[model samples]
Target chain A: MSKPAIAIDMGGTRIKIGIVKDNVILVSASIDADSGNGLRNRLPDIEKIVKDLMNGQKLTPEDIAGLGIASPGIIDTNEKKILSIDKKFGDAPEIDMEEWCQQAFGLSFCIENDARAALLGEWKYGKAKNYDNAVLMTLGTGVGSAAVMEGHLLRGKHFTAGILGGHFIINYKGETCNCGNKGCVETEASTWKLPSIAKEYSSFSDTKIAHVSPIDYELIFKLAGEGDFAAMEIRDQSLQAWAACAINLIHAYDPEILVLTGGIMASSSYIIPYIRQQVENHAWTPWGKVKIEEAEFPASAALYGMAYLVNSVG
Target chain B: MSKPAIAIDMGGTRIKIGIVKDNVILVSASIDADSGNGLRNRLPDIEKIVKDLMNGQKLTPEDIAGLGIASPGIIDTNEKKILSIDKKFGDAPEIDMEEWCQQAFGLSFCIENDARAALLGEWKYGKAKNYDNAVLMTLGTGVGSAAVMEGHLLRGKHFTAGILGGHFIINYKGETCNCGNKGCVETEASTWKLPSIAKEYSSFSDTKIAHVSPIDYELIFKLAGEGDFAAMEIRDQSLQAWAACAINLIHAYDPEILVLTGGIMASSSYIIPYIRQQVENHAWTPWGKVKIEEAEFPASAALYGMAYLVNSVG
Candidate 1:
C-alpha cells in the first residue's frame, strides 16, 4: 500500500486535479484552462481545488505524502522543473513548481512530462505491468509516447527521449507540421489537423463531413460507417498514418507491449484491429509478436503516474 | 594498458578480422564472404585467419582476454548467438557461435549487432566520447544506426532497439520497404533504393546519371556537382530523406551528439552541412542544438568496439 498524494494533470484545455492512493483516484476535479493567458494565473485556482478536494475527503496536507504534476512539454524530472512548454502552459518554464508546492502545502513534489507520466502510470500499475520493455502511445490531439527499455525509462540528457513520437516525419512529401518538420504523423492525422486534411480532398466539399462544426474522429468514423466517400478517405488515411506511427514506435523502442491510451482511444474498437494487422504484417520483430493493448486507466493514468512518482522517487 | 583481444566484423560481402589492444587494431585481415552458403561454412576460414593474424603479431590466444563478434543481425549478446538474420548470413540463427569460439580458441566471447558495435566503439573511445547520450547513423547499403542513452545501449527485449533507424517510417505514402513498411528512410534514399528512385524521375533517361552501371551516391553527387538536372533532383531528395531521418533520430533518442559514419559518409563534405542545417531548423530540441559529427574510426569502429567490449566486460 502507498500513501496518498495529490496529482495534477495540466492539459491544454483543462487541469485535472485528484487525490490518488495506490492505483486509484479517490476524488478529482477539473478546471477550465485559460492556457493562452499562461499557467501563472491558474496557480491559485489549482491550489484551492486541491485543498477543497482533500478537505472533502477529511484529509490534510500532513496525511498526504506529496504532490506530483504531469504537464505538457519537455521537463527536467530530476530537477523537478519544467524545461520547455508548448502551446499549453506557456508560463510553466518561468514558474518554480517546487517552490510553489513548498509554499502551498509544505510537501515534497515532483514533475514529469504528461506523456511520460501517463506511461509511468500504465507501466507501473496498468496495462503495461509485468513487462520490462514496453511503449505507451497516447493518441488524442496529437500522438504522444514514452519508451521503457529493460525496465528503465529513456530520459536522455534533455529528458526528451521517446516523447516526441508525434513529430516524427512519416511523410517527406506531405504538409509541414507545427514543429517545422514535414509530414509528421500529427500533421497528417491528429484531430487538430483532420479538418484541413479532409478539406484538401477533392470530394470533401460535396460531403456532410465538411459541414460539421469542428470535425473530429468520431464524426469521421460515423460518416465513414455510413459510406461517405470523403469521410472514409480521411478516416482511412488517418488510420494508416496512426498505424505507421505505431510501427515506428515498435521499431524505435523495440518493446514487447505497446499500450494505447488517451481520448482517441474511445474509438479503440475501430482502431485496434486495423493497427494490429498493420503491425503484424510490417514490424520486423523476429523474436515474436508485439502485444498491442488498451490502457486500463486512460483518463486518469497521468494522475496515477503522478501518485507513483511522488511516492516512489524520494 | 589493456590485454590484446580478437575482433571479427561480419558483413555481407566481407569479413574483417583484427587483433586489437589499447583502442587500436594491431593486426588485421579480410576475407570474401560466401554469405549465400551461410556463416557455418565460413567459420573454419575465420578461425584460420584470426590465428594467422595473431601469429603475425607474435601473440597467441592465451595473450588475449576474449573475442568479440560484430555481426549483421539481431543477436542475443548474453547468449553469444545470433537470434535472426537478414539477406546475408542466412544460417546464423542455427549456428552455435559460443561453442565454436570455445572449440577454436578456448576463449570467452561476446556478440552484438554491427551497428551497435560501431556506436559502442565511438561512444567509448571515439568522437562520441564524453557524451553519455549519443546516436550513430551509419549510412551505407542501408542506413544502419545505434543509440546510447545515458551511457547505456538501448537494446530492448528483442535486441533490436535503436538499430532500426533506417526502417523508421519517414514517408507513410512513399515506396514499400523490403521490411514491408511503406516510406522508410531506406526505401526513400538508401544506396540499394537509389537506382529505382532515380529512374522514377521523369528526366532520368535524358541525363548522364542514367548511363552509370550500378549507380550509387558517389556518382549522383559527382553528377549533381556537374549540374546534371536529374542528378541534382535525386541528390536533393536523398539529402532531405537522410536529413529527415537524422531529425527523427534526434527526436527519438534525445542525444547530445549524432555521429555519422559508413561508406556513404565519403561525401560527408556535402552531406554534413545539409543534415546539420535541417536538424538545426526542424528538431524540437529546446535544450540546445544536437552536435552532428563524423565518426572517428570510419572503417574500423566496430573492431575497436569489440575490443572495448571484450576488454571491459568480465
Candidate 2:
C-alpha cells in the first residue's frame, strides 16, 4: 500500500490542508492565508498553523511521503518557484517555497499550478480516470483550464502551453482581456467581469439586474429562469461565450473529454446540456463528439491532484 | 543523397505539380483541376494531364519512389480513403485513389489532408525544420491548420485531431459559422464568409469597399493601405481576429513556433508583426512569447511535405 501524503491547496483567502492515502481524507484543516501581507511575511504564520494541525492529529513527518502545494498563477515546476503570480500573490514568484518547506520540515516538497493540480486530481481520484486526452476548465472568477494530451499534462517546452485555456478568445472585438488583449473569452464572460459586461447592455438601468447591488451568475440564472429579459439575454450570452471557449479548446487540443468545474459549476445542470448541444451542432469533429460534463470533485480536485502528481514524479 | 520524387497539390481550381527533392522544386507544371464536373466524370482528364506531365519529362515509375496526394477534406491516411470530402469531390470518399494509381501507372500511393500535408512540408523541409512542436495554419477560403507534438502529427483516435484549427469558436454568438454553430472563427473571418460579414458591418454602403464587386482581404488591405476608411476598419478588425486566433492556437497546442501560410500570407509583412506584438503584450505564455512567422514557401509547403512523406514511407 502507498504511504499517505500531506496535500495543501493555497488560495488568496484561505488554504485547505488534508492527509490522504487514496480517496479518503484522514484529517484536514483550514487557515486564513492573509496573502496581502506578502509570502515572506506570512511564511511563519503558515508554518505555525500547519504545525498545530499536525500535532492535533498526532501525525509526524514520517507519517507522510511528501507535501504538495497547489498555488495559483504560472508555476515553474522546473525551479519550483511561483513565477509571475497575479495581483493576489505578491511574493509568490520570488519566494523559495520548496526550499523553505524542506528546511522547516526536513522533508520533500513539490509545487504545481492549482488548475493542473485539479486536473491531476480528477484524473486520479475523480471522473477522468479513464481518459488520457482531456481538459479541465474552472469557470469561477475567471475561466481557468488545464489539458492532458496522450496521458501527459502537456507542459510543453515551457510550462505555459496547456494552462492558458481561459485566455482563448471568444470574440475578436468583444472586450479587452486582463492580459491586455482585446476580445478574449475571459473578458466577455467571467464572474469577476460579468457584472461590468451586464452593465454594458443598453437597458442596464431599465433591466431587473440594475436593481441588484452585487450581481453574479447565480442571480442572473435565477432571474432569467423567472423571465427577466435583460438577465436572460446576458445569461445566454455568457453561456455562448463558455460554449465557444469549450469548442475552441476541443478544436485546438483534440481532447476526448472536457471537465467543467469551479463555483460556476454548481449551476452546471443548466450549463452542461447547452454546451454539449452547441458543440454537437458547431464543432467540426468528424471522428466523434467531444464528451462534455461536470467535474466530480470540486475544491478537493487540486488537493487530490497533488497526491497523484507527487506519486507520478516518484 | 535522397532520391527525387513527384509532388502534386490538388486544389478545387488548379493543380500544382513538380519534381522536388530536399525541398527544392526542380521543375513545375500547373493546370486547372476541373473538379466541378465530379470525380467520376473528370478522372480521364486529370489522368491524362498527370501522365503527359511525367511522360513529357521522361520521368518513369522506376525513377520515382511514390506519389502522395494532398487532397482537400478528411483523409484516413492509414485506411487509404478520403474519409470525409466536400461537394467538390462528389463521391471522393468512396473512390479508390490508391488502387487507381497502382493500376494506371504502377506506382505506390498515399494521401493526406492538404493542411496536414502542408504542416509536414514545413516541418520536414521548410521553416519549421528541427522544431518538433509547431503548428501550420493556412488562411484561405476556410482556415486550415495541423499540429506536430514531440515531432509527430497529432492524429487523434479518429484522425480528426490536430486538423480542426479553423473551426475554433472565436465568438460564442458574434457570427453564425456555416458548420451550424454560432460564432466560429471561420464564420467571422474566412474568405468564403467575409463578403457577407463586410456587408453587415453597417458602414459598408458608405465606404469604398461597397464599390468593389468582389470584396476580399486583398481589396480590403489594398484600399486600407490607400487610406480608405471602411476598408481600413475591416482590415484592422480582421487582423485582430487573426491575432486572437493565433493566441487561441498557441494556448490550445503548446507549440514553440506558429507558421502562417496560404494566400492571405501575402499580407504577412503586416500580419506577422501585428500578431507578434499582440502575442508579446497580451498572451500569458509564462515561458516566453510563442514565435510567430509566415509560412516560408506558401503554397509549396504542402508539396514539399508530400515529397518528404513519400520518401519516408519507402
Top candidate on lDDT is 1
Screening candidate 1 with a backbone cut-off below 3 angstroms (N, C-alpha, C), the clashing residue pairs are: A170-B170
Q: List the residue pairs that clash in candidate 2.
A: A121-A305, A170-B170, A175-A183, B121-B305
Alpha carbon lDDT of each predicted model: 0.89, 0.79
Give the per-residue Cα lDDT of candidate 2 at B42. 59
- Residue-level error in angstroms, candidate 2, position A151: 2.1
DockQ of every candidate: 0.83, 0.61
Per-residue lDDT of B178 in model 2? 61
Tens digits of per-residue lDDT for model 1, A45-114: 9999998998999998889989999998889998888887767777789899999999998989899989
Best model number under TM-score: 1
Please provide TM-scores, in order, for all candidate models, with all chains considered together.
0.97, 0.93
Q: Candidate 2 at A201: error in angstroms?
A: 4.0
